[model samples]
Target: MMDTWLTNGKDEGADGGSPTVFIVDDDCSVRTALDCLLRSVGVRVRSFGSPDEFLKSKIPDEVPGCIVLDVRFPGQSGFHLQNEINRMEFPIPIVFLTGYADTRMTVKAMKAGAIDFLNKPFREEDMLDAIAQAINCHRARLSTAKNVKRVRARYDLLTPREREVFAYVATGMLNKQIAEELDISEYTVKIHRKNAMEKMEAANIVDLIRQATTLGLAVHAAQPEGMANGTANGASNRDKPSSAVSNGTEYDCTFE
Candidate 1:
């Protein structure tokens, strides 16, 4: 039996998105004071009296945001809620607030991936700083996710054989070795590898490996001998320069 309150307003951050600060505390007065303070700074906020009520809210997946959580509640502790959120793989950063602070609890909160843990009656500047840091962290995470998605979309444009070749190449396999493994000629392997590189817009083996790692693809420890010897289809170690976009920036593969 908890109440939920949402304060809506517009305040663009450096990234052009109005980030939200979610406040979950059992105390009504604490929630009100926080709401007023945050709104004064033009920050959007949503307050909940319990974790369950907060979880039931329809938070957008792409929103850059953070959570301010209290340490204790009637049924579930903040630590328990943190664990649940981690299990659910939600990307929002968390800042913990507590009246009873101890060394063990602080260590536990930090180890659990909390952005900050502040004792009750903390300084306003400290709270604001923690919230800003958390929002920045969340935004960075969202940007990375978007970049990964774009890379994955480019990967989807490759042919099936090219994808298989990409996997082998990313794992440090040479052209001849990939040919033998796939029961294809070395020339065919080379062609597919080139196609994959072009489609993925990978600058070199290093860049390809980075994208593959981001995609959670398994890679080998050894480097590709062909790339090391500069025999990768006579392609240079450096990536080829790309054409300019309408914005006058080079069309690099990096989403950042």
Candidate 2:
């Protein structure tokens, strides 16, 4: 997908986030008209006369924006730019504006993750609507990215010992069973368990379990040195991790 970006517009959308729109068109008149139109709607506008010119300028990663790109260029095509953007880290949306419309080009842009493909003579209302939708998509993507970063920060607070305890607890092992598995006292297991819950900011065992599964710690819990799987004993493997009862679809995250 084209997880690329372009933007700075006036904060006009009801959703209340700064979204910029970058317009890349070779025709000076087309760029001027689009710049004025988008600015009037409170979208921050930057226009470029060529894809090469836009590429030469720096776009910040923090700005959540979209591009209004002309599909056909003098030499370097918009599709080439889209491909380059796909390799970048940021998530930005793209909407193609073209006068030379065709079935093959439309399908190619859409398949490469463009938000919309509009003909050159497109109406002003339709263009605005498309830009607004692109901004919202960028916002949602940014929010999700923030959530993942926050979740990982919390996970990083755990100690290796706490992490081990977290894994056993996530798999639904009791204090006594975990004690035997790790060759530690039941009291020590309880201490580790309590510390793990606190470090993870988990409200309870279930919450901790969801975080473990979402962060994929439940899988890695087995790999630490001196930690044996149920292959060493039966009580650990008798049942599943018991995280299925949780409706934690919102806690989707992965610590790489």
Candidate 3:
């Protein structure tokens, strides 16, 4: 498994939690310069000389930011490092900095799902733009993750009956149908559904479905008449986010 590297601290220059920027370059000058530049723009930054060192450090659990990784490193190539990061399910998005750009390399990086690639001697504004976009994406991702975590926590609080109701509700079952399935009254199913929605902090059915799925509620797709027949749909739900909590700051969890 590829080792995941994460930034191990709170965001710097946080005004209502501004995004962070991590720079991993073998060249000390590049690191320093980028750090200064990022900091000057109200972005917190951490610099590292090598990928291994970055992997060794601790990163905050969640932050709005992205990693600026050099394509060439002292030991591990950036390409391999990126692949490993993906394998580990790290949360951070990456912006690659390459000294040499080629169609093949660009294709490879894009195919591996890099956010952006910057050639050396590129304009500062371009880097800043990419960084800003990355941080915003990271922030959104963290926000979603927080909500997901909360959803799961609430799901765990439900009684086994409530959990059963939740699954039915997510699969578009009516309270009447769920009651029949579980040998309960429609009123009872409605009560349980309401309780589950309240605990999940969902405003409506759609919100409940979204939040429940995020919490791994194990909902199956509803069949044409499964609700009427009180039969399990049996088909697996295929739509769900990956296990990684990526936003911007690379928190590849594979290492863990």
Candidate 4:
């Protein structure tokens, strides 16, 4: 788990919420030059002389950013640092900077998900271009993570009966079919479905399905005739999202 001192107890940027470029290199000259160049273009930056220092210091995970990591260090290699950061909950994209270049090293880094690999004496244009691409990707990843969290929160807000109706309806069950399976009236099924849709903030059936997919909720495939004959059981656990909160019984969380 990374520390959080940079946040100063606020979500918005400790660095003005701007995308940052983190520089980790042993050479003082290298770190200073890169900082000046990046700051000149209105980019946020933080520099460290070694991998341990970088890992020890806190960075605001919410900041959209990339790392410019030196490929070779005295004790810990850049690859080692890369692997460590990749295991983090919110890993920053890495743009590798190496004074020495080789085909095998380049392939390995790219395979491990580095955004860019630049040889020493790299052009300013190339460096800036790589950093831009990395920041764009990191921003997109953060957006997706936020969306999933929001969907999960809404799912947790649903009543148990509403969640059951949601699973069935999302898989294309009619209110009548859902009512039959759950031992409720079609009118009641309709009510639950309506409430589920509202709580999930879905615009329509299509939108509702998308949100269900995002939730990773278990939904049996639609089989209307079999379901009417009471052949199908409840949803299976094969694809359930780990974060979803569920009750043991259908009426466990129903409200008056």
Candidate of highest lDDT = 4
Candidate lDDT scores, in order, read 0.74, 0.71, 0.69, 0.76
lDDT of 4 at 246: 32
Shift in Å, residue 36, candidate 2? 1.5
- Give the best candidate by TM-score: 4
Residue 172, candidate 3: alpha-carbon lDDT: 67
**Cα lDDT of model 4 by residue, 1-256, tens digit:** 0112223322252235767789999999999989998877767789999999999999887777889999999966999999998887667888999989899999999878888899888888888888877776666666666677788889889998888889887766668877888999999998899999999999998888888876766544545554553344764322322335332111111111
lDDT of 1 by residue, 19-87 (tens): 788999999988998899887877788999999888888876667788899999997799887887766
What's the TM-score of every candidate structure?
Answer: 0.73, 0.72, 0.73, 0.77
User: Rank by TM-score, descending?
Assistant: 4, 1, 3, 2
Per-candidate clashes, comma-separated: 0, 8, 18, 1
Relative to the true structure, candidate 3 reaches a TM of: 0.73
Candidate 2 residue lDDT tens string, 157-255: 878776667777887677898789789999998998998888778897778866776565543244435445553443333343332322222322111
TM-score, structure 2 vs. true? 0.72
For residues 77-172, could you state the per-residue lDDT of candidate 3 as single tens digits? 888767766664335677899888888988898677677899987678878877766665565566666666567777778888887788778766
Please give the ranking of all candidate structures by lDDT, highest first, separated by commas. Answer: 4, 1, 2, 3
Candidate 4: TM-score? 0.77
Candidate 4 stretches greater than 4 Å from native:
1-16, 218-256
